[model samples]
Target chain A: MPSADEIFAGLMQGAREEAAELWEEAKEFSINTCWSLASQLVLVGQAFVAGEFTKAEVTKYLETIRLQFIATLAAALMKVEGLAERIVNAALTAVRDAINGALGFKLIV
Target chain B: MLRAIVVLLVVLVVSGCSSFQLGERYDKSLDDDLSAFQIEAVTFVASMRLNSGTPAGAFTSDAAKAFYPKASGTLSNIVVKAGLLSSRQCPINGIANSIGLPTIKIGGETIAADTPKTVVTGNCAVVTLLALQNVLADLEASHRDHQKIGPIRGQLAIDDINKAVATTLSGLRAKDL
Candidate 1:
């Protein structure tokens, strides 16, 4: 039978790899969104200065962009938070199961 | 017509500048929340370490004795880094102030103006907390299965561990706000 320690070691190794992958994904999404928002803002500013857009039109455009940026940020943050919670819960359950399997005692959380 | 163009230019520049400032403020707020979560994590890990005192006798299996301390140390280091990231002042705050930009000190050491650092730090805390919980679980299990190995002094109760984990997890969630 594999020792409880060995089981935990293996589980944690897997958990770390998973966490790193999630982090990288979030990072990429954030960078892309920031760049896109900046580009859109610059284009809007250029149009406003060129008199192509009225002040009211520029205001509406900026507001829309702002709202979109906020939404994207909120979604990304939620995804990362959810991932963290899942990782923690999964680790606890895995350890509990490994120990129970090894010792044959029902371990209650 | 020229006057109107200049007026439009000023409006555009001011509005654009203000929007960026607002974004920076939002990012700072998020960073502050992440720092708070990091502190909470550190406290929880410290409590776990305190509860896991050296037992009177050796563990029954060589693996138990070898892995327990190693896992504990690894968890401790992760918590420390998270704490540092939270408590230190962001290097960007000062630079932003000098450049006439609105500056908010979101306490943390991260690449300048990077909000993803907060998410990364929070995830790191989660990973460490989970690993610590696993180690504690393994120790408790080993103690239960091997009576001859004797008791681990100050060994944490399962209830206490569960409670701490719950608290830490909630704190991490709260940081999303």
Candidate 2:
């Protein structure tokens, strides 16, 4: 067994690699989230079975194939939660802008 | 197989934990620069307003000065620290890895070969925003004596909060996720 330091070091590397790989996962996650229609859903189901997913999953699925399934599902979970921050920022900005404009003070400028 | 799964589950749980504070614990250099900037900006405009001798009336006509540091020594400290963490990618379950209580320890009670942990920066921006708010609130509370608030100074603090929040928002991007 790798020492705990070795293990942690590996995880960090995996995360870095995964962060870069997030783009493909993001596209895949987006497709899954959209679930356009029956045809699209079928394709995603296929992809899920095939083990193609976000970088976070790469770390997760590494444990096992079942873990991989778990990883992909969590990636989808990540997508919803991930996009949420974008929405929050947009909302905050909207609120901030409105207040700043009203107050005639540039809060962020 | 059962043992592997159980052990792997433990590792995964630990890895999942780091997601919050994947970044460095705290950037001391950034703190120093930020505090210094705050003191300078606060002192200057504040004293200027006092000396300007503007009449004590609502909506004074003095042109307000804006105080915003064009750069953050903070980014340098954060990036440097993040770079270091980036090198240590292997994940291990540690206590600090939890939300805001950053204790970087890894337990090796049970597991397969070496297991690695992913990193997270946590809600640091939120923490900073809250800290700033508390400081401002406390200042307001303490200064009830004279009730002195320079329009410029007040505006600067609000601007500071907005800027900090914006920086924080950028980090929430999926790439950072």
Q: Judged by DockQ cut-offs, is candidate 2 incorrect, acceptable, medium or high? A: incorrect
The local distance difference test score of each candidate is: 0.38, 0.36
Measured by lDDT, the strongest candidate is 1
Cα error, candidate 2, residue B176 (Å): 19
Tens-digit lDDT track of model 2 for B54-132: 4431123232212222223333443344344223321211321342211122132221222242233223332323323
- Candidate 2 lDDT over A20-77, as tens digits, reads 8675645543443223222222322232334332223222222222222222332233
Query: How displaced is residue B13 in candidate 1, in Å?
Result: 56
Clash pairs, candidate 1, are none
Off by over 4 Å in 1: A1-30, A45-52, A105-109, B1-177
> Model 2 compared with the native: what TM-score?
0.22
Q: How many pairs of residues collide in model 1?
A: 0
RMSD of each: 28.9, 25.1
DockQ value of candidate 1: 0.01
The reply for model 2, stretches above 4 Å from the true place, is A1-109, B1-21, B53-177
